[model samples]
Target chain A: MSEDEIEAAAGASVDPDARHAEKMRKKKAVRDKILATKTVEKGLIIVHTGKGKGKSTAAFGMVFRSLGYGLPVAVIQFVKGAWETGERFALERFGDLVSINAMGEGFTWETQDRQRDIAAARRAFETAKDLIRAGEHHLVLLDELNIVLRYDYLPLQEVLNFLTTEKPPHVHVVITGRNAPDGLIEIADLVTEMEMIKHPFRSGVKAQKGIEF
Target chain B: MSEDEIEAAAGASVDPDARHAEKMRKKKAVRDKILATKTVEKGLIIVHTGKGKGKSTAAFGMVFRSLGYGLPVAVIQFVKGAWETGERFALERFGDLVSINAMGEGFTWETQDRQRDIAAARRAFETAKDLIRAGEHHLVLLDELNIVLRYDYLPLQEVLNFLTTEKPPHVHVVITGRNAPDGLIEIADLVTEMEMIKHPFRSGVKAQKGIEF
Candidate 1:
């Protein structure tokens, strides 16, 4: 149809007041329904694991998305403390809404100290415990947390209890690592096991910038 | 001091325009200079795999996030297809931005048919090819896609070429399956290897509603 014809056709009927009132009524119904449903929702435990990659990064995506809502979030990096450029900048922007505690001593092999890893984990759990119990944080991301449990550096049952029992109903917990404990999975609301069928590292491709951290 | 006296002591006179403009200027500067330097971008491949669980559901989280942005996204399930409550209800809310070509044929084992699997993949790929080539789509999640390559239902090199050569620079692709091909990994900008350390199926946890799809 021509532009003039389409415009005239759309304007064939003129009921401004009636149409406006109808639209208002319909809009009010939708608005009310949304407002009624938008209450405090249940918290979730998102466990990301597998041979395939992108678990920690995916969890961070959730952290950013939740932060986008202006909600409080806490992130604890278990295996890493590289002092990444990303976290340094995010700290300034997100400020108090986001709390981060990295080990500062890179990976375990770099430090090569089992006791140090346990000490670091203990400190992170202390911070995380407060966040979970206080009910202030809407999201908590435990980055590469499974390594702690896998290595027996932290008590799995205790951590699982904290995740299951201590976590406030409104606070979401995201755990990213290679090996997730079965106890956590049993209690988790959502569990993802990423099986590595193929990886770029296998094909001799180093992690690219902006794609991998 | 009394509450009123404390308030008075803390209060300070300030120009509203100066205050607002200062904040705005600071924000703009950060957006242009500081934050611009920090690398925080998303367009990585999330390869959710394993003999474990929740691969497709995890990818759904990203699909949900993208839809929240009001951008177009396409999900192509490779082998298994059924009317899941997730897409039928939540995804439909986004209308044309989401689609599911559920073959209603469940999985390959149930049917014991290779030919049918290949046919379904072709159908899904037809939709995916355009989404990858077209830069308009913000995300394209190929659910169970890696399986097509593993099951040898589709040629891996052809799929890689399409995903690599034809992919729009800004568009992001997510491939989920038990095994992703080596070629796909080699070409992928971001490849995830999900290693399954523990699974609930071994511990006798039947797939429950709201926990496992």
Candidate 2:
């Protein structure tokens, strides 16, 4: 017996399998149409910001991916300082393909000096500018830059101008931190805001070495 | 002149710098107190979910971090299949430190057969169970397992039972996909929902080599 006839004899109103297949066929056609229209290829100004974690981790994931292709990448930690992180240690194995410069003194509360914080931010931004202008790296990550920008340690206008006008067309930039500025969000090609639904910290779980760092 | 006296003479009601310093000092004390209470250490059930990018990317980030420490890790791709992704390629360089199993035939739409999809999921879950029970790997990433569970391809209770009862301690499990089950989220230690604020696909920009894949 045919599948539809068997289903009808089995007291089913319709052949669910055939119906689902037909539905998926239409969906695939729509998806193909949309995907075919997307042909543009260029470096994206990607932003990862929110209260949750993985802002820098996701950026580092991209860095590792870039390194896999033997692509040059630069990482400028604007506010994390030069702590020995698991990612840092791992990326170091890549040798000359990756350059990670943790330029911040520490968190603002840890520093507690606005002038010193501003100076550090300025220095980091200078490094970022040099890297982006040189276009030597395929991917440049401004880690925790949104934190610096949120605190007004660096001039937002100057940073925006540099990113929009001075950055090379082929250099992909990933800016990550909480409280991304509206101006930065406006110009970003892609943005993902990670929302913290539940955290182990709330249950008195300390951050592990390899996991958190 | 004393700093406070100079500020007073300059018509400032209070020394802003001194007040700021005092405020930060108090904040630090509170933070330290909370941090001191957190001493628990164990494997974490981390969930990366929601309708945004980076669910799998962030999981892969943790995988890379784990590999950096020379930890054994296994990645079971439930829906992605054996595509030539940048992460897969990059992770391959880790050799025996990492094992990536792309067991899915494809998405449900691509397969267009519910029974086949269910069989594939069952097989993949069996592999996951074996890995978790063996406790051989320090980290196990069930990439897109949520997609399988969401479709009811595998029994959720069975999966939950295995995770809670059968899995060995000290094996950190990272589950990635959208619409993670409430039961899984309830048992998870850390859950971050990646919210899509904007996407380049809307602007006709296709996924790039290193950035997306």
Best by TM-score: 2
True C-alpha contacts between chains kept, each model in order? 0.10, 0.63
Q: Model 2 captures what fraction of native contacts? A: 0.63
TM-score of chain B only, all predictions? 0.73, 0.89
Q: Which stretches of candidate 2 lie over 4 Å from their true place?
A: A1-13, A81-83, B1-17, B81-83
lDDT of 2 by residue, B1-213 (tens): 999789779765466576666666777788889999999888889999999888888887788888888888999989954234677767887899888888898987777777788899999999998988899998899999999999899999898888888878788999989999999998899999999999999999987888877
Judged by DockQ cut-offs, is candidate 2 incorrect, acceptable, medium or high?
medium
My TM-score estimates for the predictions, one after another, are 0.51, 0.92
Report the number of clashing residue pairs per model.
19, 0
Highest DockQ: give the candidate number.
Answer: 2
